[model samples]
Target chain A: MKVQVLYFAWLRERIGQGREVVETEAATVADLVAELRAREERYDLAFSDMGAIRCAVDQALAPVETPLDGVREVAFFPPMTGG
Target chain B: MSEADFDLGAEAARLEAGEETGAVVTFTGRVRGGGGLRRMVIEHYPGMTERALTEIAGEAARRWPLSGTMIYHRHGSLAPGDRIMMVATASRHREAAFAAASFLMDYLKSRAPFWKKEETDDGADWVAARDADEAALERWNE
Candidate 1:
């Protein structure tokens, strides 16, 4: 399966790019993160503190345990600070 | 995502235009200046941002008897005292209008996919989300 992955704010800074298409067999958000973290030192460091990270699946906020079946996009970022 | 400033009076006037609307409430958020802060850069997820904001505004209307609601937020570089965003709600009565506006603000503060980074004399850094902001959302959830 393939999904468009997006990074915002510090995550994008840490990852060196804002967007990418990743081919993965991950079933859930956590699994996808695990795959990403295993890819490079930068990914591992950026994802080191999942406690500070938030994920959205297909543009809607979702928990890490959220299933990625049929999901086309996933975004990772720090908690929102909008007003 | 627009970076241009929005007019509150114009928005409120438009929101309260309907004859059925008896009251209108508006809230404006501005960047605060202090402690060597040069400017703030806001980053947002493009498609998701519009979707989240629309959903939040829709939820506000569903939760309250709002005659109309408007939410406008800015992205990109902003300086101290710049108007960051504004929310206006019109209703048959003041209570609903006020509550809905507050509700819109609370949700926008947390649920909206926007992040703020502060550029200061020392350096630039991402602003951490406050626990209070998360706690503020709970009050709206039944």
Candidate 2:
């Protein structure tokens, strides 16, 4: 499956881009993260601590265990600080 | 999304409030000055941001008897004293309007996909999400 991965805020800064289209066979959000982390040093650094990052699948908040089989978009970023 | 200051008074006047509407509640969030802070920049998830906000507004309406609801939030660079966001809720009674506005705010503070970075005289840094804000969201679920 392919997922449109997005990064926001500091995550975007660290990853050096806002979004990317990834060709992956990962099944879950955590698995997808591992694949991204393995791809480059920046991704590994941005995703070093899953506890500090939040994920959303198809614009809805999702946990690391969330399945990505049918999902088209996934976003990663720090916890929201908006008001 | 607006870089210019919003006319909140004008906004409230344009809000929907028919003869049945007995109350209209509004809340405004502003950036605080001092601490040598120069300005702040907000970033959002674009398409997902609007979707999340609409979902939250729907949740607020479902939770309370609201006649109308409005949420306006700004992105991009903002100086101190700038208005960060606003929420307005109209209902037949005061409690519903107040509660709906509060509910929308709570979600905005946490669930919204917006991030703020503060630039001060020393340098700049990303504003971290507070544990207190996350804790605040729990009250609604409880």
Candidate 3:
């Protein structure tokens, strides 16, 4: 399976890229994060603390345990400071 | 164009256009000039932003007796004193209009997909989400 993963704010800066397509069998968002961390040191550093991150799957706010079975995109960022 | 572009009077006029509108509630968020702040940059999830805002606004209307609701948020680089965003709610009574407007602002502040970064005299830094903003949503229980 392939998934499009996105990063925002400092997460985008730390990971050095905004988005990418990855081939994986990951079932949940947590699993996807682990896969990215295993790919490079920068990923490990950016995802060093899971507590510091929030995620949205398919553009909807979702938890780390959310299944990505039919999801097309997953985004990771820090807590929103909007409005 | 910058802060001078938007006209609050025009927006209020539009919001008050409804025939049965008896109360028009509006709130404007502005950039503070103190703390040596120079400018603020806002970034958002492009595809999800409009959807989130619409959902939020829709929910506000459903919860109150509002005749109309308006939200306008500016993106990209903004200097101090620039208007960050505005929310207006119209209803037959002042209570519903005020409550709905407040609810929209609270949700927009914490739930919206936008992120703000501040550029100060010292350096540029991202603004962290405030605990108060989260606490503000507790009353809604939505």
**Candidate 1 to truth, TM:** 0.97
Candidate number with the higher DockQ (1 or 2): 1
How would you encode candidate 2's per-residue C-alpha lDDT over A1-83 as one tens digit per residue? 67899999999999999998999999899999999899999999999988999999999898999988889999999999888
Stretches of candidate 1 off by over 4 Å are none
Most DockQ-accurate candidate: 1
Q: How many residue pairs collide in each prediction?
A: 0, 0, 0
Each model's lDDT comes to 0.94, 0.89, 0.89
Just chain B of model 3: what TM-score? 0.94
TM-score of each: 0.97, 0.96, 0.95
Candidate 2 residue lDDT tens string, B13-93: 666548888888899999889999999999998888899999999999888988888888999999999999888889999
Better of 1 and 3 by lDDT: 1
In Å, residue B90's CA in model 1 sits off its true spot by 0.3
Q: Which candidate is the best by lDDT?
A: 1
Compose the digit string of candidate 3's lDDT tens values, residues A8-58. Answer: 989998999899998989999999899899999999999999888899999
